[model samples]
Target: MKKTIAGVDIPDGVMAQAATDLIRGTESELMFHHALRAFLFAALTGYRENLTFDAQLLYVGAMFHNVGLNAKYERSPYRFEVDGANAARDFLRRHGVAEREIEEVWVGIALHTTPGIPEHLSALVALISAGVQMDVRGARYDEFTAHQRDEIVQAYPRESGFKKKLIEAYAHGMEHRPETTFGTVNADVLDRWDPNYRRLNFCGLVLGSDWPN
Candidate 1:
């Protein structure tokens, strides 16, 4: 039984289907689940906010924000923002979404991983999605090579301190090392992983818009 959070019901079946679609031919189910959880977290958080645009569009944007992470990572170094945006455009069009709605979703997906996106519901989704990625990676920083950790630190230097703190909190929560559980996906993953890591990281990055001194 999967759990619900912020009105987003994430069941095992839904996650499994998403994972199957995401991983496709990959062996990294853990990565797939992490990305899926991040998307759910983003959608839930974005929906809980006050937005000027249609909430359903935000939901759709969040659901497909990272749709291209795996495929893009295979070709290049985690260029999910660009690839994901393109993928979302096609996916949304296929599902009969309007052109305007598709554009909003594409904007959300493109800016989700990168900084400098305007402050709006779509931007919120992107911010939350990055936070989700940080949560998953922070917990298992040791699992990642030194180079990978350095890349994350470089990519998000503005939030490095807060991210370090959040990672520390995550480490404390997981007793210093978090392990991934296979064959199942649940909200506990978010509870244990904690989106607050992303939340704080986003705050730090957004508030400190000026380059790190």
Candidate 2:
């Protein structure tokens, strides 16, 4: 049986199992709902772009993209993005998915929050990043009809304090490992929560270059 959401037919066999369910269950209501909306937006973006992609792969990428914010992946030495990326890779491997396909999902989640590149990359990866941006910051909000936005939100309500909760989750996921957030949006969490957190300086690196320009 195929699951339908906002007129998108989720790919038939990609995500139907006890393990996927168990992994998804780890996120909070907010993250879970956000995941659904992410998929909708990703699918919508793909449709608009007229790009052919593996819907199931996009679904799985968006679905597990935030698992790093959960307790299981939060403690890993790797950055939260990599943690989620690794989790996705491990899950697909366990399910016997093709190695090449698994790598696509891995790259998608790993670069989901990475600035700039994901958008120009594979459709599966691009969709996840675009979806997340539209959901979080309303990037290209005008591209989506009001009805479309309302319907997706109705299905996955963005509860009150969602923004605050999101920040808290990010902080919780990376607080003890502040070094990992240095170059990603995850840095904001540390900046807000840990007063001592300092961002790296680009000019300082240029000035200190071993070979003077």
Counting clashing residue pairs in each candidate, in order, gives 1, 0
Q: What is the lDDT of every predicted structure here? A: 0.46, 0.82
RMSD of 2: 2.1
Which candidate leads in lDDT? 2
Please give, for residues 19-81, the per-residue lDDT of candidate 2 as tens digits.
Answer: 347555687778888887988998998998898888777878888888887877655888888
Minimal lDDT window, size 10, model 1: 177-186
TM-score of 1: 0.45
Q: After superposition, how far is residue 171 of candidate 2 from its true place, in Å?
A: 1.1
TM-score on alpha carbons, each prediction: 0.45, 0.90
Question: Whole-model lDDT, candidate 2?
Answer: 0.82
lDDT of 2 at 99: 96
lDDT of 1: 0.46
Candidate 2: list runs displaced more than 4 Å: 11-14, 17-20, 205-213
Flag clash pairs in model 2.
Answer: none
Give one digit per residue, the lDDT tens place, for model 1 in 1-213: 645543455444433354346444442333344444454444443444443444345444445554544433444333345556786677667667778767776776665544344344555445444445544444323533465445433432334355454433323323221222111121233345655522224466667898766
Candidate maximizing TM-score: 2
